[model samples]
Target chain A: MSQAIDLDLLPEPTTNVAEYSVSEISGALKRTVEETFGHVRVRGEISGYRGPHSSGHAYFALKDDKARIDAVVWRTSFAKLAFRPEEGLEVVATGRLTTFPGSSKYQIVIEDLKPAGAGALMALLNERRVRLEAEGLFAAERKKPLPFLPQVIGIVTSPTGAVIRDICHRIADRFPLRLLVWPVRVQGDTCPAEVAAAIKGFNALEPGGAIPRPDLIIVARGGGSLEDLWGFNDEAVVRAAAGSLIPLISAVGHETDWTLIDHAADRRAPTPTGAAEMAVPVRAELHAALASLHARHGQSVTRRIDAERRHVTSLARALPSVDMLLALPRRRVDEAETGLGRALRLSLSENRRRFGEAASPLSPNALDGLVRDKRADLRHAEGVLGHALSRGLAAKRQRFDRASLSLQPRAMSARSDAHRQRLVDLGRRLPRAQRFGLERLRTGLDAQWRVALSLNPDNVLSRGYAILRRPGAGPDGQPITSASELPMGAEFVVQLADGLRGAVSTGTENAGAARTKRARRAAAHEATTPAKQGLLFE
Target chain B: MSDLNEPVLPPDDSDVKRMSFEEALAELERIVSQLERGDVPLDRSIRIYERGEKLKSHCDRLLTAAEDKVEKIKLNRAGKPTGTEPLDSA
Candidate 1:
């Protein structure tokens, strides 16, 4: 099995080869890749796409049936990518080829990429539809019931597009309500992310914040190419649609263009205008419906009342008449009254019979006999009492005569003589006592008179002190001890040991003070005037 | 946060706006049913009928009196909606 090949065919191994580090070789290869295939467009089916990495840089492999090439989309490039790379999607990726030194692998750094063709895009969408369907995102049960009439409707679409204007016009023509538009790029590299964000943002709105949360959401776009509408097929957009708390209506393209969001949303409208129509009922129609409802309500109520009234009337007719119902009771009452009168008359007659039977035994003759018997007994008692009384009276008279005989007049005369002598002795002693008392009282009066005389005003006058007074003021004038009390030219009195002497007030006897003194005396004599009023108010 | 699973949050009453169309409709229906039953007394029937009339009027008013408010969400640089602006921005 071992066949020896020619020695010359095997080149000799060189001992002194160019010395180069692994980095240098790798760098050379990297440079060669960058320069030679700086820009290339390759068609392949995307494989191993699990979305972008955490760094936002997408790492995947593009492979045809024959071969596969590693692809790298940097975060910036991925952001600018017109369409997201889907797993199993056929795309024509355009980018520069470079080597990853770390992994020792060559890769294309994609800048711009798109689906290879409309057919390929459709295939990708179908594939996605199947995968998402398997994941239950497209399940009918996941759909939310659209609000009957949303107070606030949220729209996820481009702000400047005709699609938005159409939606607004349609909504205005119909029931005009609060519509909160979450502006997004309907078609571009950022379409999916922006649309998804818009959906999530509307969901994130606080229910009662300054901005009200939307009760319904419509992700709408106008008619465009399949490529233009591809963003709606994005997994992010579909997932967001499926996860919306508010019921969502997808209106991404024309009726012919269907996107994955259509399957995921609660409802699908043919166009943006259709979405608006779906969101709210026509105002005129709603008014008409409400009016009809109101009429129906009124009719039902009136009918119920009429029916109830009829029922009441029938029930009243079935009831017995008041007079008929009371007839038996009234008759019974009258019977009872008549029976009561008869019973009273019968009882009266019965009472009379019993009284007559009892009275027969107690006739007047029998009563007289009883009275005669009682009188005879009383007469016998009286005779006996009189006889005993007379005997007792005779005995009492004899005893009295004996008692009188026993009494002595001499003893009584003797007692009266003693009493007279006692009266005479008492009378004599009382006069003697009265005379002694009179003498004692006279001596006490003499001592009191001596003390009173010693304290008399005459005694003070004899000691060289004379009393000064206002002349003619009183029998005993008010005293004036100081000369200041004298008014100029006014007469005053001075009392000596003998009597009060009148004098006239002349000059030099407190000349200035005298005028004020007289005025003060007069003022004091006058009745006091009412008190001077203090400040009554500020 | 799909409405199919999560409970619908109650409407905010702090806002002075009248009842929403759905609420008014539902209430009107309920009152109609109540009034249709003859078990209700006359006084109570009249009162509830009046209430039903009010609810019906509220629904009707909601349909006609509402002004169109089409405000597009204004987004920040990060593509996050910060608030809203009128749709027809000249």
Candidate 2:
């Protein structure tokens, strides 16, 4: 009976039991678990990373390139994080192991996590870039040129927000361009369609004949995360910008951020104000450029003018007048005058020779002498006539003297008787001798008259000087008779004389019978006496 | 010919001959792209920087003119624009 008491005292080979309460037991188990795996490192991709909220708790996942794990942290621990925890983040967590008894669940109470050094995010980005480049989406040739000075610019942004105002203010401040504001939601469900419509609206204004069809377009918004800037990344907005007729300049967010709109746009600016600055060139710079160009053009034009002037001067020098005038052969004025003088002298000599030849036959003195000789001959003829008349008178006187002597002897005997008879006869015819002598003188005068008449032109005509008679007055006014008188209708008669042809007209005497009578009478009278045919004598 | 060895081609600068603002900006972008691509040699990269310097100066001048305009607007806030204002003098 003592031996049985000794075995009981030896604790009967008892089970290992803990000497603590239920709460203490659980606490101790947790402490052991934590101590065994104190500050462990986990390698997994983050699936859900709820960032630190107002509750100061963060729940997130650590994900691989494909799979992920859940993660959580309290406020105190999360506050110490250098980087924000997020879903799809591959990270390594440093935490103590903990367990819950209610569901018997196990987890890590995360104290810290860091990027796993290499992330799938960077790989994904690179892959996308490569893909876009392969498709020539990012080709430099695809890029367009922007306007140097755009007057009207269209902007796509939220209607009532600081983004639109910020853009407008900056653009207005820089350059006072015509701004056509196209308001659209930058975020939320309607953002994609609204952004696309705004870009399309700007294009529609062009086709619809709107004033100042937006020279440049700027799609812009403030900085945000990938989700916030997703509107710009929409395929519609990107396509709209790419297809737009006008140049587009995108200014989506901060410099680090990029979007699809930026890639497809004609140009990209980091900020809204930066985009506005590119739209216009400065007035001052433009003025300088214009001045330089003007100077250059002026110089060129001046050079051309100078060249033309020189060419004209040379042409003037080459004219024909200069060469032709200087090249003529020489001649002397005095020599030419001498030659003319010699020609005049020869002409005078030739004229003198011709005059001597023509006048040699008749000397001036001989011509005067011949005229004097003819006058002397005429005087001789007149003197001979005078002598002959005187001789006749002398012969008659001698006859009278002889007859008187004879008569005187006879009268002496019968003187007494005849004296008485002669006295009586003397009384009857006083100076009968004087009377008879006067009678003889008269007879002598009559005979001389007959001789003179025979010597006259009329008597000469009777002696036979042929006379040409026309029927009428001719150019010489000669007489003409017969039907042939006035052959061409002229009128006159012709009288013949010794040395003269005298013309008489019977044309105006009378009519036809009277004219014939006058003509017959004239012919009869002309034929009456062959020796003397004068009417005065008749 | 010896004097022309440097090949001093005339600078293109005038209202008609000068490059447009957009052209200058596009060249600037090419320079940036060349630098980012890293495919260029170091010497080429330095050349690109030199080219970029000129473009930057041009951009700065443009910006300066804009700043002056801003200042002018602030000064002219009190009066209506009159026909007598000389635009050339401005």
Most accurate candidate by lDDT? 1
Lowest summed lDDT across 10 adjacent residues in model 2 chain A is found at A500-509
Worst 10 residues of 1 chain A by lDDT: A529-538
Which pairs in model 1 have colliding backbones?
Answer: A181-B73, A245-B1
DockQ of 2: 0.04
Candidate 1 per-residue lDDT over residues A244-330, each given as its tens digit: 998999998899888999999999999888888888888888777777778889898889888878999999999999999999999
Task: For residue A118, give model 1's deviation from the true position in Å.
Answer: 2.9
True contacts kept of each: 0.85, 0.04
Q: How displaced is residue A85 in candidate 1, in Å?
A: 3.8
DockQ of each: 0.42, 0.04
TM-score of chain A of 1: 0.51
Candidate 1 local Cα displacement, residue A322, angstroms: 11
